[model samples]
Target: GKGSHSNDVGAIQADLPVPSDVLIYYYEVTVKDAGERGVIAVGFADVHFRLSRQPGWEPNSYGYHADDGNKFHNSGKGEEYGPPFVQGDTVGAGIHLENREIFFTKNGKKLGAAFQNVKATLFPTIGLHSQNEHVEINFGAKPFQFDIEGMIAEEREQRQLAVLRSRIPAHACHDIVCSYLKHYGYAETLLSFDQGAYTEQVAKDEETPQAFGLEDRKRVRNMLFEGDVEGVRQLLIGKQPQLAQLQEDPLAVGGSGSGHKGAPGEPFGDAFFHLSVQQFIELLRQDKIGEAVEHARSSLSTFQGRSHQHDQHLQDVLALLAYKSPGQSPVGQFMSTAQREKVADIINTAMLESSATASASGSGSGSGTSAGAGGG
Candidate 1:
């Protein structure tokens, strides 16, 4: 059925309340039946405004005219706004509330902003002049061809980032990045970080309490990789001065100097047993049966009665001796490259734990170290 412009206004029978949250409100119009150069307008107007002329012809209304693709508002038709609407062409009108602007699209292609600073409450509207000028109005009951939600989210994300920028100091954030770069052996990145625009703001004295510096971590990690247990011991003692005493007299066997009261054999006890086991295993791998036996008797024997894990590991190391080709037996699994890697991991983890314990003690006296799993 064709809607004739009885008095210039031909509003759709339905009206919708536009939501405030959405960045833009969209309406699509499709011309179905019309005369040559037929005039059809699609836009928004006050619900009470007579749809006498095109939506924008009245003071509180806005419209995109299809005849010349001109914009109309407050009884005045403005410049070209969109492609002329012919039969079967869809014209979409969008009301952007954020900027108080309105725009039109011809066949889904934006024709640019049509009006600015629109503040009046309006309803979806359309107008036609010809008797057979038929048009369909879609108030978004179906999915839009454009990704409006994605566009809105992207805009909102920018706004949120702006808010964050105003709150967090730039230097503090970059310092974390500096730490990460050093951690991953990105020396050039670390150097470049110092040359960044934030260099002046990042004072050297403003050190974020890093438990283990990257250089120290890398040095210790390399020592362990090369089966340098003595070097690992020296590095740990140097980083954690207290460890020097703990190494001489392990905490588990009532070493009185340790600050905590029986803080569980978790830290020092675990590190001692694992390192001693690795030394014993290394001796066996070198086929120094006599030295390996002496190491087990002197270092590994203390852990046998300390914990079940220690006892189990000790037994496994002893089992390695039963095979004529000790490196070829099931117990020889511990002699594989994987086992050597585990020794490095144990040292790294101990360094982290010791650093964390020291920091959490609130002494705030030593360098900070972190534990991270190394990728082989």
Candidate 2:
């Protein structure tokens, strides 16, 4: 609504304060009519801001006025800021929480920072000082005229780079990287990194007892990644004969012959399901539709109706067959290298967890021997 008189300055504040959890918060306003005084203002103000007073005329408030293009905070006096906005002009205000700075934009062009060290639980506010001061506010219901997404991305990249540049002991960093490689079964990379160690401390750390069956885990991971699902199955069975038994009697998980309280097949069932899906995907990728269908019927059909998640996954996997170019299909994400990596990561984590469980239980029955099978 338009202001009734010069002193009848009208202002409005959002019901909620600007969110501080995020890296940035911003809003924009389009001046439909600058009116008699062209004194429209857009900024932020604390809860105590008076509705009848223009924002920035009192304490704990900030504003950019239209007539003079000056910014005001905690005072009636204004400071030089950006170009004055008028009718048909779009203006924006933003708070960068990381830097504690407030800035404005005119017609989608960013103005420099207007205030520093802004520490207030402020609300998005607008002020009208005279008649016909028509304006429209956009609180991100639509695309922002400013590239706020890009700003957030840049901030995240800068923060990550800062962390990377922080000082840390070389041996400590090497050990962390080496552990990551070993955990993911990147045996070849681990070997290369070990050989490239620049100091004796790193070389000595390498001699520490590695995870059990590091080579086996690496081989299975490589085979899965290479689309050799059959090879992975064969290798697992050869290395851990118990896996063949588990496949025959899934209820025998954890080697608790009589009362195994866990889910039937437990993690092994999960691993084999993922592997079967990956095998089906690989077959489809090779355009062997008949073979893929047969494999799905033999392996995947048994997993259906087991759970909603399993049914949904099977549906998505089968959806790929309807597309001549599965890579471009809606379900194409399942065909990506990322999908294979996801399965491999899950398998690796399952193996590590099973081995850790077996070692902790101190079972002389060699339950850890089937850790790789459990992952498969």
Best by TM-score: 2
Model 1 score (lDDT)? 0.66
Q: What's each prediction's TM-score? A: 0.44, 0.50
lDDT of 1 by residue, 213-234 (tens): 4466567656755777777777
Candidate 2 per-residue lDDT, tens place, 42-70, comes to: 99999999988878887889999999999
**Candidate 2 similarity to native, TM-score:** 0.50
lDDT of 1 at 22: 77
Clashing pairs in 2: none
Report lDDT per candidate. 0.66, 0.75
Misplaced by over 4 Å in model 1 are 1-9, 167-376
